[model samples]
Target: MEVKVASPSASRRSSQTKKLVGGKRGCHVVVKVFPCKICFRPFTNGTSAHLHARTHLNSAELEKTSLFHAKCPHCQKMFFVHHHLTDHLFVHLSREERAEVAQGWRHGCYFCTKRFRVSSHLNLHLLTHTKEKLGGICHVCRKTFTSKQNLTRHGFAHLSEDEKIALVKQGRSRKCLFCQKKFPDNRAYHVHLVSHTKEKPFRCDHCGALFGLKYNLNKHKLIHSEDPRPFKCDKCDQAFSQKHHMTSHKRTVHRKLKDFACPVCGKKFGRKSHMVGHLRSVHAKIRHPSPHCGKTFTQKGHLGIHLRKLHPSEPSAK
Candidate 1:
């Protein structure tokens, strides 16, 4: 028989058929074969060829072309990854120019100097900073919130004006005996009482840790499990399991913005919760009245101390 060699396409098809029969399946099986420009290695898939071509590039060329072959939308600069392209886009502007642009375009949190992609997200994040009880009170349930936005959200659970009138006519009121607070329903009343009783109904399976809220229990379970931390900081070596932690780190450590200020003492805090805690401890004057004697203090802990020292005969609440 005369010696013969098959055409490139025919040889590729033959190889593909052999691979299919051997139970080897991939993108290279269907696509037109191409050789890498740098190494001249045969690759049926373009993406594989592109990736293989990168191995031949030096460090400088790799850095220059690295962004997964993505082109920047703003300056048309090429980068290896999407984030690299985004970072490079900022390099086109000066510090003053960037600051001026940020004034108009950036949606940033006042407490930690964290910037958000959207205004709604920024508004939602701002709620985390207001640790003090909000003045907005729900007329239907007498429930207070830290913000009018939260009050509006709580109002959705209550009956409408017509429904309220009908309930009044029926002489039905859902009220708690312990706190004398009204609720939308009996279920809401019972749920409210759980807070005062400090009930931990939700129990974790992996760890016997109990949480009052089901969501808090779920969040706690993440600590016990081996979860992947996909969100990584591009500016530093640090990586966080949660996006909020990453955002917080960027704000407090990188931006160094202390937006939360105590209303009574005028002390600045990086977080709203810290400011609220300081106010409660130093200024709130929340005194637990002694059942035996009329004694008051700033903190519940102090009341406990007084009870232990002066009124040792009386039993403590906890």
Candidate 2:
């Protein structure tokens, strides 16, 4: 009876040992083994578990990045690291965007009817048309991102004026050295870089609008609005809402017909746009917005603001 009991006990002990060894068939020998809660995959140790969590984190990050980022202002892709975004914005700040603004027609999506300085800007414009929700809902505005990095950056936009002031006072000027541009946070800057490259990985099969930038493209869809321009001009028989519309009208219609000759030189132009081009070429000293003004603006909006504040009496129409 004693021999029989010992034999059964030894067999049971061997069975328990086999079970433990079988569980570790594919596991590394040096590290502790455990099951990952998120992925359900067996991990070598705690470090591996932590690293594995990043896979789960990616979904959140992608949403945040997509929502906050505009587009690759350069290549116009949705993917980028922190430093790459900086390198891209340098292109926009270059002469290209400025020249397009001068030409009156900016780069915009024909499908969405949205315009931007760069193709990347149009990429972000496309994200708004997405229907899917990403990441978690932002506490401040209920907005979402593909990731937390995007969400956190967006949160700063909701900061109060005093909070922003405090942040600036702390000597925390979050600027990217590559582009010499500044942002409230790294995430916002990272998100902004998405506007530089043209890589829309996510595409919609329905509308056929290819977007690399965002998980959500619902904002790109158009909706009818009550905001309509009713103002029309009698001199050239044109319509406008803002005063600039009238100026664009005059430039396109009446001014284009006028053969004005410069008194300083023998140059004739039908319109001011053509004359501005002529002046820029021959009399480089006589710049369009004034070379001696000690300031150069990227867009007409900035010049309009300057005129409104500095020279209130001057007409600042288009």
Candidate 3:
């Protein structure tokens, strides 16, 4: 946890030192004598040396260290902050080198290279990656936790009613028989149970839409605002409130980039969903077949869409 603080005299002392030839190959013949105290890597000035010291802040042996912050794929050097790593690539790496390895950079996000100053902010950002598909629910129990710590201690959720009540009296657990989901407090337990009942107390005032989560309701309310669409397409006049939607628009429309292509057919699609839909409709046989006819569809929703279009007289499919 203990860190060595850089003294004010570092910069002054660096200025007094004479330039010398570096030991590393391809290094400048006459480089600034100032070097990192720990690694002895040559730098132009002491300020850079001090900044470079942050790279050493992260280590498996250190108690105050963070997750692998910023790793250089080239020399295997690490930087403690993303901005510092960015500066390293721009200043130390050649233009062609940066372009060659730019895609290798890793971040907390699986889909994008977005970086955050705080680890907690990064943790929050990661939830977005799962929320769209899984609705923030844990794949293990098919339930979501308000806090990350709760998910770790989820085995307690399976306790019997008597044991759960006893734990609640001991100020430890909040569980019920219905969903078998545990909470840290009585308030959270009550909220979790309400979701099971499909109450959806949080209602949007603008469109009269109900939502189970208050945060979801708040997000829905933004659509009715004067300037709800904050994220705008740089190339086009179209805009969207969410950053992901805007990014999808750019990829599908402006960029016309396709990451996935069908092996059976040479057809391509920008979005993974589109590619999947194409595969299920064109190539793969359907699992859901109509009882009335031999017609088949990849999804129940797709079948329902067909029914509405072809058989307008027929009632809506449940």
**How accurate locally, in lDDT, is each candidate?**
0.58, 0.48, 0.58
Which residue pairs come into collision in candidate 1? 66-80, 67-79, 67-80, 67-81, 68-80, 134-146
Which ranges in model 2 have alpha carbons more than 4 Å from their true place? Answer: 1-174, 184-186, 223-299, 302-318
TM-score of 1: 0.29
What lDDT is reached at residue 164 by model 1? Answer: 54
What is the full ranking by lDDT, best candidate first? 1, 3, 2
Reference-based lDDT, residue 76, model 3: 34
Location of the lowest summed lDDT over 10 successive residues in candidate 2 = 1-10
Q: Is candidate 2 or candidate 3 better by TM-score?
A: 3
Q: Give the clash total for candidate 2.
A: 44
lDDT string, candidate 3, 260-314, tens digits: 5665697877876787778877788646666556578788787777777776665
Clashes of each: 6, 44, 0
Candidate 2's displacement at residue 168, Å, is: 11
List the RMSD of every prediction in angstroms.
Answer: 25.0, 24.3, 26.4
lDDT of 1 by residue, 24-70 (tens): 34322333455443223456677886787665333445567333555
Instruction: Compute the lDDT of residue 179 as modeled in candidate 3.
Output: 54
What does the lDDT read for residue 236 in candidate 2? 53
Clash pairs, candidate 3, are none
Comparing candidate 2 with candidate 3, which one achieves the higher lDDT? 3
